[model samples]
Target: MSTEHNDLTAANREAWDSKAKEYDAKPWQKKIASQVAEALNSHADWLGADWASASDQECHLLDYACGTGSVTRALSTHITHATGIDISSAMLSQYTSLLSSTHPSLVLKTSVADLCSPDPQPSISGPEFHNFDIAGVALGFHHFANPATCIANLASRLKKDGVLFIVDWLPNKIAPGEHIGHAHAHPDSHDHNHNHNHVKEEETEEWKKMKKTIKTNGFTEEDMRKIFEEAGFEEFGFVVLGEKFVLEMNGKKVEKTGFIAKGRKV
Candidate 1:
């Protein structure tokens, strides 16, 4: 792992661990999480058909940066089996509770694996994921200090013709803006809003979270294509969501946030 990626893993762990306790209770988080997962499932209808045509069985999917396994739980209905990995133990603990309560037999599993660390992946202890059909990341990836390298590692883990479904905050629109000041105007401005104590300190410090990080890490669309191609991915495309295209300037309703990249390993 690169030193930069290591730093990101640390930051990501801090952010998620801080948010884990309140995550389920936050209505917005719950709604967004569910929507992202369901959108992925709809996308599967398009991508899954290709895998099905290739004779793939019930999908074996890995949820990367799976904070509290919300996406994992949401994905259970679409795939045969799912496994979640994160660097935050607190998030995984919540994930464990959610899995235990629902989808107990969905081949649901969780592990602590820092994608930016030099260490090997913690034991998954299962026959599945050996040749997983699909791999996914939700609102993650940008947290990687070296997202290009992270993508390479993830792509290498897939079976031939496997698909990688990536959903992340796009720097183009969702990047943090002058909205901090505007946000202060909201009627619900409590201590958490003013003190910045509730949210991760770094989140408030950054301008556009992923943009600066990606530039600092030297990652780009070309970098993604190169890594995926080198890892034997045969097809690739992307969907930009939220922000300008999905919403009007008036902030009525359009898209929510971020973009999704899908690549097929061949």
Candidate 2:
């Protein structure tokens, strides 16, 4: 890996490791987890025919960048086995704890692995990591230094006709001189706040440090489609959720519109 990419990976790992405990405790995070889980389950068709027809034991899932097992928990009832991998060991610990407590019957395992690396670890390159019926990353794409390479790496692990999906923020347009911030908002809540500059001046430093870990603010549908195609995937589908994810950053709420994109391995 280039020095720049290595630096990005290190920065993100450090940032997420430090915030893993707090991230797992956030109510908004839990709420968005439920929302994403519902969206994925309701739109199963988007995942492709392989996922729909596979028996529980045969339905293998790879939740890459799987922090706290959000995607795994979301599909716990549907699939019997899942493997989760993340760069942050702390995040993987949270995922392991949560999965054990809530879905003990489900066979979900997690490890600290960075598949996006130019040379993946030996354990990650084994047969067990390949031939997944479905692979997914939830709210973790923006942290990747090279999302296209990440997608292609994940795609190479899937069996033919396997599905790959991503749930992440849609591109947010910021006006000049406006700072990005999120406030508490939900689809059912009538009280809405659209302003993106409500964060207090004191929190700038914290937000700045956090922003350094993010490679991109968001992604557009066109961008997603092209990336998926270049990654050797077909049957592309994208859905923008009606609900907004309320994020707590530096004691301020940041509302973000989320979307789901999926494609089948060709």
Candidate 3:
């Protein structure tokens, strides 16, 4: 790996380790749990709509960089089991604690290894990696050091006819703090009593640091399409799942216009 690439990966691990607690503690982050849950359901829906009904119940999922495992919790019912992998143990720890409480009987596994490793190259098959029917990368593309390798790894892990899902913020051309807005409507029971700008300064600082090291502002449509194609996936489909998330960080209301993208392995 290039020095810059290694630096970015290390920086992401450190940044996430430092901010894992605060990141998960944010009121918005907590609220996102259900929205992500809903998104997972939508992924299930999409699979049924685009593919067949028989494959629904037996599918296994891989939650790549599954920070806090909110999606894994939501996905408990739709698939046979799910495995979450991340580079930060702190993030996985938070995920485990929440997983045990929210879905006590969930069959979940976690690892603190880079799925996008380049040297030995992380394995994507066998008892260790498992054959994932659906693999989702939620809001994680920007943190990748080499997206081609990352997507390739993800694509390689899928069972035949399996799909890869990518959900993330739309790319932008400006600095932070411009897209401020009120939080979206979520269920009242999951709501919290917190201000939008509560962690503005800290997140903004993190954003600045991300601007320096993160791979991209976010992935564009063409960017993602090319990525999927380069990874040897076919029949790419993109779904606009609405703005399911928004957080005021560093005084900027970062609105999340998520996409439920899928690439089938033919």
Candidate 4:
């Protein structure tokens, strides 16, 4: 990876780490995360979306950049074992706590590892590495500084015929504007005492910026497919969630959703 990409990965890691604490406390975020998980779990059957169930087989699964395991919990219901990875320690901590409290029987495991980096490929070294039947990244792929290299690294860790699920924001959608100027920009930061109106405005602006930035970061249906294909994924196809996510785009109402592309490791 280039130095530029390395630096970007560092920044993303920092951003996620800072926001981890407050992210866990937000009730709305909890709802959204759970919803994402539920959607994936349900939609899998329709798209033949089993990462590990090739030939009706069961296998271990990994959730890359799994923030607090929102999707992990959803995936856990279907798969026997699921593990989530994030660069933020705090976020993983909260995920573990949540699993222990809400779903004790679920075998939810987490670790602090930057998926964008080459030196410390967490999934490959973790106890679960050899066990993973499929690896997934939800709404987290574009954050990589060098997406191509990251995709290549992730692909190397999977078993033959093992699948990879790449889920993220799709283009041609409405979204909220960026609110970093008014609301809490850091992850560990909180703004409970802030006025409701101010929060709304900030979130509105933030939503817009997010969409723009995601576009700038080289995110799109075509880009995702190319990256996965280049990294040795085959039989890839796109799947989008029907739910409309509310956000602001240039001060306009926007409903942003995601698409999941699944492929087999050739």
Question: Any idea what lDDT model 1 has?
Answer: 0.59
Cα displacement (Å) at residue 42, model 4: 2.5
Sorted on TM-score, highest at the top, how do the candidates line up?
2, 3, 4, 1
Off by over 4 Å in 3: 48-57, 121-126, 174-213
Report the CA-based lDDT of candidate 3 relative to the real structure: 0.68
lDDT of 4 by residue, 129-204 (tens): 6546677887676565656766776677677777777776554421233222211222112223434454444444
Candidate 2: lDDT of 216? 69
After the best TM-score superposition of candidate 2, give how far the Cα of residue 123 lies from its true spot, in angstroms. Answer: 2.7
Error of 2 at 109 (Å): 2.4
The local distance difference test score of each candidate is: 0.59, 0.78, 0.68, 0.62
lDDT of 3 by residue, 72-133 (tens): 77677766667888888999898887777877755677777776676554433356575677
Instruction: Please tell me which predicted candidate would have the highest TM-score against the true structure.
Output: 2
The best candidate in terms of lDDT? 2
On the 0 to 100 scale, the lDDT of residue 156 in model 3 is 72
Clashing pairs for model 2 are 182-253, 182-254, 182-255, 183-253, 183-254, 183-255
User: Model 2, 1-266: lDDT tens per residue?
Assistant: 87767977898898889888887576787888899899999888656635423443467889999888889988876677789999999998998887899888777777788876767677687788888889999988877877888899899888999889999976555433222322211211222443456453454665656766776667778889989999998899999999888776655566788899999898
Q: Give the range of the ten consecutive residues with the poorest summed lDDT in model 3.
A: 180-189
